[model samples]
Target: MTLRATIVRPDARIVVQFSCGAASAVAGKLALAQYGATHDVQFLNAFLASEDADNRRFLADCEIWTGRQFTVLRDEKYGADVQNVFLRERYLKGPHGAPCSKLLKRRLLDAWKKPGDVMVLGYTAEEADRLEDFRERNPDRPVIAPLIERGLGKEDCKAIILRAGIVLPYMYRAGYSNANCPGCPKGGEAYWRAVRVDFPEVFEARCQVQDELGPGSWFLRYRSGPRKGERFPLRELPYGPIRRNESLPSCSFFCEMAEADIIHKEPTA
Candidate 1:
């Protein structure tokens, strides 16, 4: 008598997009490393914003980890278009008005996606809602959530990165939260507060966008909170000049929102 083992090979090509965050980027890097080591895989740098030192660091880390050259796709042009008012009003409205994600992330992904290729998203099981949302939106794309499949939450992913000896992005350390952008519209009041305190220049730029686009424009409606409330008073908060320090606030975006001022006072006419 004889026994035999069968190896099942994946049908679709695997590609992980690096977004430059503690959890997502690390997860993507790990996936790239693992798949590249055992099977054929491709890595992509779908950078939607300007190249910064932090972005370079993530790329370098990916190179070191995967021992392979990663392909870079420039999507900064798409990100810039979202800054335009006409485009925002004409195409995106209400919940979709902020086109940052669509322009910066989604468009790039669409351009790179192949019919049979599997897109590996960094969403974890803890973010079930987001995972479901991604699946719903990209029904034809066949998205794969390896982090969720592995039962690794954000903290676990962070621990993996730390254990791997790769430092997280400076924005994460500065307490601005998500590494998407320094002043992402998805950020909450405390996120803005942290921005105002830690990255004054970026905060000022965001305020300028608000001033130009009018209030309640740049940030996500829920995350922005009420129009009348000030999570951190603009007058009292730090602004203009930038400063840097090694230590970061203990809490990141997830925990910081709770401490923010959430109430909105009625506007006086």
Candidate 2:
């Protein structure tokens, strides 16, 4: 079915994109507190098949905590698989962004968005550049980055989620910072190394795909290190410490919001 066909309610003007991460859960709570009484707030998630099973558990807990049903959206086109798109388009992630993300989420969000609806995203204070980039790029999407606005950090979000009685996702327990898909295509040497220890089968599958994609097509591209711009396949990735401790910045519906912002900013025909 098309994305527009999945809209049971076409008029939810206040929408929250729940990434099923700690900060996202907390952001949804804050949005509900601010706007639920005055507007019909809707919570939406663009589903990813590669995500851990415990992400569902976290989603369930957030539903209970927020007292609202979270809508799970899928890209009917790609069926939410990055590999499927990679194989079909003969391309994996590029320097600009992930094709899987654009086809699945960014496009879906565009089709699902209603005119004048407010989009709530979970971006923490540390991601000031991303927040600025988003705002600078999309000046008319009626978007709100609550965590950034409040100067809340990752730990603050975790504390709020725990106080509300929601257990963190299993990925967190396993020392993963962001609850992105297993073996996220954008991961680095440190990230893939951690994935090898945490999920071997996933690591193997990613390696196989990298081999299939040839030497130039790789998941990560290093900028400053010895290997700069060269495709660093997961197969050769050495075991190392995970990136920047166990703390990572909040996950955003990055491309989707950017697309919406740009489209809405255009002069209407």
Q: Give all TM-scores, in the order shown.
A: 0.68, 0.83
Top candidate when judged by lDDT against the true structure:
2
lDDT by residue for model 1 (74-174), tens: 65555543344223443222332234555555556567767677555666657656556445444444555667767788778777877878877666565
For residue 14, model 2's alpha carbon misses the true position, in angstroms, by 1.6
Q: Per-model C-alpha lDDT, please?
A: 0.53, 0.72
Model 2 CA deviation exceeding 4 Å by range: 1-12, 221-229, 244-251, 259-269
> Which 10 consecutive residues of model 1 have the lowest summed lDDT?
254-263
lDDT string for model 2 (1-269, tens) is: 11111122334477888887887788788989877887788898888777888899899899999999998888767778776777676566665556676777777777787787777778777765676677678665567667776778888998898888778888777767768777666666676677788788987877777778787667565655787777666777755566623343334466545755666667778
lDDT of 1 at 143: 53
Measured by TM-score, how close is model 2 to the native structure? 0.83
lDDT of 2 at 43: 92
Task: State candidate 1's TM-score.
Answer: 0.68
